[model samples]
Target: MTDQKKTHQPQPPIAVSPDEAARLAGIGRTTLYAALAKGDLPSIKIGTRRLILVDAIRDWLAQHQG
Candidate 1:
């Protein structure tokens, strides 16, 4: 009997840094920040770092889509 090793796939992050969120959303950092500032998008701040939820980014984009 041969034993096979199972391969694990990496899961996507639930939250990401602002820069990464911007890249994932296909928007400029400044635009992303503006949305965050305007309360159009939600983010969480830990220490001095800001993180945006991946789901929030997706929902925001969907809401703004023409």
Candidate 2:
């Protein structure tokens, strides 16, 4: 496959840290945690860490972007 194709390929279960998730969501870490605590954000427990699916996040943004 071409380099561009590789770079453009869909990600499978993108894992992000709390800090990175906050940055991507345009909120502070505290706010991110607050949402998580309130069960407002989508997440899954992977092993010991909490993970947010990239497809979920993308769809969320698309909804808001419209």
Candidate 3:
């Protein structure tokens, strides 16, 4: 019997940097920062670094539909 190798693909990141989050949310970095400051967009801060979750961006868009 021949051994078959299983290939694994890396999954997309669940957490992203502020710049990437802004790009994904289709808004400018300044606007995103504003929203974050206003508590509109939830963010996770780790050791003086802020990280945005992909799910949070999607949820924000869903709840802010015009």
For this target, which candidate reaches the highest lDDT against the unseen true structure?
A: 1
Can you give the lDDT of residue 7 in candidate 2? 53
On lDDT, the stronger of 1 and 3 is: 1
lDDT of 2: 0.72
Q: How many times do residue backbones clash in model 1?
A: 0
TM-score of 1: 0.93
Clashing pairs in 3: none
Candidate 1, residues 3-59, lDDT tens digits: the string is 999999999999999999999999999999999999999999999999999999999
Tens digit of lDDT per residue, candidate 2, span 1-66? 656543577754476767778778787889878877877677888788888766656665565574
Which scores better on lDDT, 1 or 2? 1
- Pick the winner on TM-score between candidates 1 and 2: 1
- Model number with the top TM-score: 1
Q: Which stretches of candidate 2 lie over 4 Å from their true place?
A: 1-13, 59-66
lDDT of 1: 0.96
Sorted by TM-score, highest first, which candidate order results?
1, 3, 2
lDDT string, candidate 3, 2-61, tens digits: 999999999999989999999998989999999899998899999988998999999988
CA lDDT, every model vs. true structure:
0.96, 0.72, 0.92
Error of 2 at 21 (Å): 0.6
